[model samples]
Target: MQGPLLLPGLCFLLSLFGAVTQKTKTSCAKCPANASCVNNTHCTCDHGYTSGSGQKLFTFPLETCNDTTSSKTTQGRKELQKIVDKFESFLTNQTLRSTEERQEISSTVTTILRDVESKVLETALKAPEQKVLKIQNGSLAIETRVITDNCSEERKTFNLNVQMNSMDIGCNDIIQGDTQGPSAIAFISYSSLGNIINATFFEEMDKKDQVYLNSQVVSAAIGPKRNVSLSKSVTLTFQHVKKEDPVLTIITYVGLSVSLLCLLLAALTFLLCKAIQNTSTSLHLHLSLCLFLAHLLFLVGIDRTEPKMLCSIIAGALHYLYLAAFTWMLLEGLHLFLTARNLTVVNYSSINRLMKWIMFPVGYGVPAVTVAISAASRPHLYGTADRCWLHLDQGFIWSFLGPVCAIFSVNLVLFILVFWILKRKLSSLNSEVSTIQNTRMLAFKATAQLFILGCTWCLGLLQVGPAAQVMAYLFAIINSLQGFFIFLVYCLLSQQVQKQYRKWFREIVKSKSESETYTLSSKMGPDSKPSEGDVFPGQVKIKY
Candidate 1:
């Protein structure tokens, strides 16, 4: 009886398990191809596929799975190809060709180039998984490269070719800062654009030789900012271009080198010569230091276009240093004005204290803030294609030029005010010959300083019209040798500084003579040792 009962119970359990397994298989049988049923209750698309309704899990039998990876690539290619088609249409349009004014044609060409570059870069960034995309339409061609991984040590730059035009860009330009995601660059070439914007647009071109566009009009840009300028100059390889004069390059290098040396000497004099250590000398020292660094960087790295991030950093540093130099110059003018105003005061301890309080903040902090704001707003304008300097596009150069002009104007006003004050002081002190002479000397120095530090910069703005060539040369020559002017005025011309220099020279000569005499006596033998009177003991030595 027990065996019979146990057999019946086991059969009933086996039958129940079989019925459940059959139900589960029937439910999963409804799942479509390229999809799998989960837990016998819901369906999920297989790898490399997505559900039509975008649901990860679904019970609907009508849902279908689609290949998404292939579709995305197709969509990205179509989008880029569409850009090429649109650009080709724009260039071939009859309305664009009918335009007469060269300026209008040039402006339209620029707008078209920018638009094409921006759209290509945008599309590439949106579909960064498509690492490389190239499309060629009727008269236009575009190629894009997307970087999503760390650049190898061996490959610091990437090159993109479109038609006969090509661009070489630094890897860091695309990666930008430390962003660990994708960065994309687009290179575009227009076969017909050069016809519209030819050599005629360049006013500097010689009219004697018949010049025309010899290369395709090409544009290159990086996303997401898509600035007109690049951090490193994109080395554009085209069919035709001219070379710059080597003579001018040599002159520039030599001039800047000499100026750097002079600035160094001026800074040292301002620091070491206690006689000239005042608020004015402090201003001079800072000015010299700023110019020294600016010139040194300009001479060495101005044309360093590789490693885009480094070039941009160099450009920003140059911007800050030059602005700092001008700011210090403004401070110099302010100090000169204050000194002139308080000529009657025997001591300027109060003035010195005031300057000390405000000078560092205004002189250095102002430029730093200015550069920060400029960089934050339009970082792409920090470097250019030809040089590691502010780009002259979209009025971006005004970031540097605007401040310089304002400072120059303020310095000019201060100079005039100081001159007026000195005149009044001189007229009132006419009875005292010593006072008149001092006032006259101050006036002369003020006049010289104004020209040396402020007015010469005006030559840069005068580089237009028939005299432009003359003004360019003059500007380069005078401005490049600014350090020489500073050294001459602050160290060589100042009576107090001149005296200190003479004293230093005498001390150096005296030390050399004593050393020679001691060596001679030592060479004569032990019997010829110098006596106690001949040896100067415990004399205070200056540590320069």
Candidate 2:
């Protein structure tokens, strides 16, 4: 039994080895064309042509197209021309085929045939079409050609002209999820080979639903053979919406002047108005300033760079700033909770100090770290055109998603505890549970401030779809507008800042056109501030 089994196994192994060696020789190995030395066999198929895999250009067993004396060379040439024409259409990547590519392949086939004493066929033509050597009566005659070595021998090693518009692309292929249309899909090809690249999964779009918005995804790489290819893609959960009900365009600037002016003044308030500045409000001011500046820079930077990393950097930073502001707002919540619980509000001097430090890591550190890790793990992920992104890695959920879920949970607990503490202490005040009661009113006020301060900023980090573009504008408005709101609240809503504002407002209101009043502390001299007449249209001046 062992002898019988061993015999078949050895034979099978030998045949497989012979097939592999022949295939390898065919791949790049050179041997006599149409001639084999195996057991004195003179006409074995080309080293690799018939021994193993697919068809070979010069399979050894058939080097000469015709060896009969009855056949005419002209007819054989036409037959060979047909095969060359059919296959030449298949070469797809070279822009200009040099004589070198054509020559190398010719030499490989000729070397094998000359060894068999048979006529060889070889010729190199121009980039578009090629010609073959005339073979008749077992003799060879060739045409003189200049360019060679530019065509691929492999079946897929051909050139294809691809012309596509980035705007006409759709996301139907990527978002393929549980029985729905593709979350997103992209098809891209390059004019170069040996370079591997593909589009990333991002953006939420559906053409079956008649939605039209180009997905924004970008990736580029140089493959092993120095072939250059680039791909970008994005995918998201499917949602249906009216196509005409929305449009985002540069023309959306119709009413943008007012928003821009307000944002500018809001920005200047923190930068120039010392009386309105503080650590607590400064964070909001910086956030607002960054957002406005980022948008402004983006508008200027687009179409300016070879690759456009600045727009992406500004965009990503804007998102990071939004979250940072929210981190600060979280700090605000913790602070307000302490204030509401104590009959006397807690002093925030030290806590604010600690918070100032904490916000950097919570707001800046986490996003930065996550981005860095993702880029290092796979640098192809950096500065993608896809909307605010997280890594595809599962742990990325823990970085951003974990924080979001944790923050929401913490907010819930803190919110409940705030009410619980208030209710327990409510009995001591011996008052009915009036919605507008003193403590309740104060809590409501705090809640309102929290909403005014951190609410919009928190909308990011929600891990939603490609809404970052829209959410980015919202982040800018809420973020930049917060500076003005904070100034109005702490500086104008309070009696101290308000009395000061009111006194100054009245003085200016009642002043002579020639004489102006200022708000840089009444104790200071008139020389301490700008003249009241200095007021200009659309410009806000708060001296104090």
Candidate achieving the largest TM-score? 1
Q: What overall lDDT, based on C-alpha atoms, would model 2 receive against the true structure?
A: 0.42
User: Model-by-model lDDT, in order?
Assistant: 0.79, 0.42
After best superposition, candidate 2 residue 107: deviation in angstroms? 30
Each candidate: RMSD to true structure?
A: 18.0, 19.6
Which ranges in model 1 have alpha carbons more than 4 Å from their true place?
A: 1-243, 429-431, 526-544
TM-score of model 1 vs. true structure:
0.57
* Clash count (model 1, backbone only): 0
Best by lDDT: 1
lDDT tens digits by residue: candidate 1, 46-144? 866799999999766778998776766676667656766666676557565566567776676677677677778767776676789887644667889
- Where model 2 places Cα greater than 4 Å from the true spot, the runs are 1-279, 282-306, 343-353, 356-367, 384-409, 422-427, 430-442, 449-496, 507-544
